[model samples]
Target: MNDQYQALYQTFRWLVPTQFNIAEACCHRWASSSPDARRIAIYYEDESGNREVWTFARLAEAANQLANGLVKMGVGRGDRVGVVLGQRPETVVAHMAIYSVGGVVLPLSAQFGPEALESRLCDSETRVAIVDHASSANLLAVSDNCPALQQIIGIGFADERVLPWRSLLARQPNEFKAVQTRSADPAILLYSSDASGAPKGALLPHSVLIGNLPGFVASQDWFPKPADVFWSPADWASTGGIMGALLPTLYFGHPIVGTRGRFSVERAFELLERYQVTNTFLAPSVVKMMMKAVPEPRHRYQLALRSIMSSGESVGETVFEWCQSALGVTPNEMFGQTEMNYVVGNSNKRWPARPGSMGRPYPGHNVAVLNEDGVPAAAGETGEIAVNRQDAHGYPDPVMFLGYWRNEAATQAKFKGDWCLTGDLASVDGDGYFWHAGRADDVFKSAGHRIGPGEIESCLIGHPAVANAAVVPKPDTERGALVKAYVVLTPEFAHRDRNDILENLQEHVRERLAPYEYPKEIEFVDELPMTTNGKIQRGVLRLREEERAQAPAANTDVGAPLVAPAQQPET
Candidate 1:
């Protein structure tokens, strides 16, 4: 290890107070400390270019009023209150208010359809939902299915059954006392993306925000710089958005920009240039899209971006090199899941980043690659990436989630002894850089050789013709399985001859990666299936391949022939 990183890691200590509350630390404390009530907290702009600025005092006041109103509406401590709004001022207000009232905040994405909303709302037993006009209809449509849902607070519009957000706050006093919640108290209930089955709620305590600080600061290159303005397209409903971007930025008393409406590449650049965003948390998928949309962003836009942290999927060498060359900053890639987040990541300033590798474990987190027997894997050995329940000092890790809400069995299954299994597969090198393998289930045997889709997929993306790709094992009679790839062509190469492009891509992977890892068969697709949070859903593709193997007659294509690409429905 380098002396600089060793010193930082060895000397670091988590100073979690016995009593802590996210609302108090993020909004109320800052509001009360500042002499000026107009200190800006959030700079909000919608897709239409309409803008609004919120001050700390205004945020705290609205939270207090909303807290009082929620109390009056029978919301008590530990109750699940759903905040189904987009990146608007009300979303922030609702989250703070729920936390202030000692209620568990269930942040749901506005992009969710009625079925998706119903499943999560029903699963969490969310009682009162605070929603904006865009999400209210979906929530209301599924309210009948969600028996626990009693009150619906509508932001812009209301009906006879729903209560108006403004009216509810106006009727209550704007001076509610912030709840003194313990550091270990349940604060937020986050649902998993449900790639395997139904989504599970991972209950996070108030100390999670504290646990997230080390990695957050490290990933943002020791954040809270004087002129650091933060922005991210990550949805606040998810861990990457909330813990990675929103909460940590707020805790540091920095102004964060939020925009409403769908995220577009043009809009992202516009916001960065307009707001002078200095730091951002972007998913690898979004980063790839941005890389494709504008290869030379720095030349086109006047950006102040100094640091960027990307997660969700592997950030390949192509994207890594692109960020440094185009953005003038080396993007730090972070790795974590809903249960335990921000545990491992890169800090370019502290330690040099090895592209395509998940950096050493962040300070205060004890992480290792564990074999099936739960023992730490040797250097260059593949295994599940797991985090210890206790830190290196033997103290309980604050970053760990409370447990799965109402599902103890699932929670118990998540751990092997004291290690919390992340279900992700990786291998640690001698230098402590963790290289990603595919998910445990995603890795399969092809001709007596174990192959990970991640390496092959990363190799595929390095090809200029490919915009995004997913590799899966296609069943074969001779070899147990053959490496098959589903590729999404870049806009420039979309209409080209698919047969020639397929051969070129096959050669591209064979030359760069191992010959065994080269996809024996390649299928061009309009788009790969993606989860709502913007992860390429390899499981979906895997299942399709499995089904095709069973019904060979229904799917007779054998070789890397270019048939019409199937259009995948938007998630």
Candidate 2:
């Protein structure tokens, strides 16, 4: 732990009073600070480069109107409101309005299918849903199943039954007195599909917004001030997007640029340059896409990016090298999940990052690598990474989730006394830096040795020819399971001779890892399945492998690519 951050962490609790509301604290307070304040709240743009701007006053007024409108529709405090929208100005307004009226906001991803949408709506017992035209049909399909859902407000289009957003807000007053709520009141419900194999809702309290401040302050690579511009390619529905990009930046009264429509790498670069964005957060996959989309970006655009933060998945060495050369700064890797915001990360401003490590625990967060007996693990010993629910002095980690919504048993299973298990495996070094060893469930046994896919996947991704890689266990009668690799090669290496490439990659892994840890089988694919949050869906891959194993005349190699080794033409 860095001693320098102790003072800041201690002072963070006083920032939010006991009776607090997220909207009143983050929005109304700034808008009403002065009569002539023209502080820009949002700088938005569509796919074609058209721009839209919102001042703090304009934002608060719009949110107030919506809040009042919801009240008129019989929605009030404690009711769950679902927000199914994209990263647009309306999305921000919806979030603020929901909280202003004291309604618990359930953020749904725009990419959710009809079944997924139905499952969450029914589970949360949502009374109202705010959606854009793109997601309107999905919500409508599941409305019948969700008996509690009474109203569906459409952003762009509306039917006889569905209400129009702009028309409804126009009828309501532009002023609303926010409901007073305690810091422990529920604020947001994030649907997370953790190791349990099913979606579970993590209920976050209003204090969570303030709880994240310590991590934000401790994780800054460039130390964002009140005036810096913030933008991110991550979806707002993801925990990192809301905590890292939207909430913290907004709390500081900084202007943020929201992306709309499809995310083109060229447009992203344009936004960074046009907005003169000083700070930004992106998932590692987005960084890789940008690297592929613009090979020599430094020569094409003048980027004023002061710091870059990445999370959602483990970042590899290749991406780090690409960032330093292309963006002129090292991308700070942040680690956390929906259950907890950011607990560990590299803050270059305070402490220099140990390359490829997860960095130290943020101030006020008691993070440690623990063994099976619930004791702290020694340096270089692999164990579960956990955060103490409360410090030795009885200071609770405010950033943690209140509990898994409506699932008391699941919540209880996640903790051991004061330590809350993160379900991730890692090792602490003598210098206090943590190294990721993948999820505990992702670790499989092969030949009496526990193998983590993360270490192997990271090693494969470090190869210059490989664009991405995922490792899974293939059923083996002798070893119980053998390592099988799914690889996506870069464009430059895609058309090369497969035999040579496979041999070279196998040799590469063999040299870096143990003899048995090397992938016994390699299958090249065009792309891998990914979740809404940009994480590779290994669950889907594992299921496919199981189905293939049970197929008629099933080859020992599961889900082998249709294209054979000789099918590749020499390039």
Candidate 3:
């Protein structure tokens, strides 16, 4: 609502070119721009402390070689190629190679099990997979079921039946012309879970990276500052990792640090200190874990982090304050989905960031809170957060995905007229900042009041004893439903008397939030269900509560005793 923000939004323009290839823009051009072509692109370290550095020259050459190899094997434009690797150097190389050949890149998580791998590969009809040792077995296990899968290229492991990554590159020419691709050509096929837990592919165009720039730059506090080193532990398989962190950093011709292993708080701190990382994109779960593991990171490790962008879930006020006091930086919480990402976020430098608010729409995006009838909701009214296909200037938004792969009906259903529905619910204040209510599916009605899990979860997370929490509606006969919370206690508080902890949590919410919003029942659990991308699976918890209600011997006590330790399954 301020004049400065209004001016910034009004002056932004989209400059997408007719011919654009992600590989050319992120790698080859940077390589050829400089005479030496020796600018560092990646600094890689493994769990065992093995280190390697790749310059733009090396990345481009490797991509060219791989592109040639893939082409010789009959892979062409529009063909699907899977990159099932973690945050290693080859992951970046595989994406570049896929883009260079105009093949659709399918970035799969290395942590996926056989069933998950089969679902995505078979759905995408992936022709070839470039994988590391960790993911090779699971991919191979499902390859027989995926008839379209023609070849498997393995890295860091030997198998006579599989093509070695090095051997394939060594036999191919080191220089090949990258296929000319239009800005609207399909570049990536990212699989996200649907309502039924099945994977649906969202095909992103080459211009998707261009679309992500404004929000990325703003969230990272006007990124690419002098010598700005970037790092993120988010998996390269997801949008937050690749689009939000990797591709954006690479587009600016900056070096990004990657480590191959499970993320630990200690390792994260060490890497930030060792690399002097100035910008990072962390998920809310990672931020919370860091807050719990190290209350004061700056005290133990030397850091130069200028900006931290957190998404995937709301970075609650508790975590936001911790970042300011402990990390010496205010984290910008971003909002978007796999189909359309980085649409809404906070930029503390440009405008004041309201903690727990998913800031205003990024420039070049037309966002609004839409009611069920597709009309924009008035201020302070809860509705679905949606983005228009066109910007304020009536230009096509480059950041929007092409469509869900081969699922035209589902794609059509995603939009209400020109507005693409995000399936997330929020309310805009008079000042235009979006306050998250909850996921549309996650919000529930208790008595006559609609209850959103986010506000209660945020309140629970602020409690010192609670490390993380998920709020869900518990089925009730008299009251229709009741607010129920699953709490994950901090290590120090895990073994404390459960009854006392539960009572304390109930009172904490009752004193802070509305009495009706306070959890009527609390369950202490070892951990809540989480997605591979670190989002709490409130759906899973909600389903569990529904099942419990249908049981023959269901407990109906409003003040029931705390349940014994139970571990929720991973979603």
**Alpha-carbon lDDT, every model:** 0.85, 0.78, 0.85
Model 2 scores a C-alpha lDDT of 0.78
- In model 2, residue pairs whose N, Cα or C atoms come closer than 3 Å (at least 3 residues apart or on different chains), thus clashing, are none
Off by over 4 Å in 3: 1-3, 442-571
Candidate 2 global TM-score: 0.78
RMSD of 3: 11.1
- Judge candidate 1 against the unseen true structure and give its global Cα lDDT, from 0 to 1: 0.85
Q: Pick the candidate with the highest lDDT.
A: 3
Tens digits of per-residue lDDT for model 2 on 18-133?
78788877788889977524788889887666789988899999999999999998888888999988688888888899999889989887866565677788989999999988
Model 1 Cα lDDT, one tens digit per residue, 11-97: 888899999999988888888876645668899998688999999999999999999999988998899999988788888899899
Better of 1 and 3 by lDDT: 3
The C-alpha stretches of model 2 lying farther than 4 A from their native spots are: 1-16, 442-556, 559-571
User: With candidate 1 superimposed using the best TM-score fit, by how many Å does residue 252's alpha carbon deviate from the native?
Assistant: 0.3
Q: How close to the true structure is residue 52 of candidate 2, measured as C-alpha lDDT?
A: 91
Question: Which candidate order results from sorting by lDDT in descending order?
Answer: 3, 1, 2
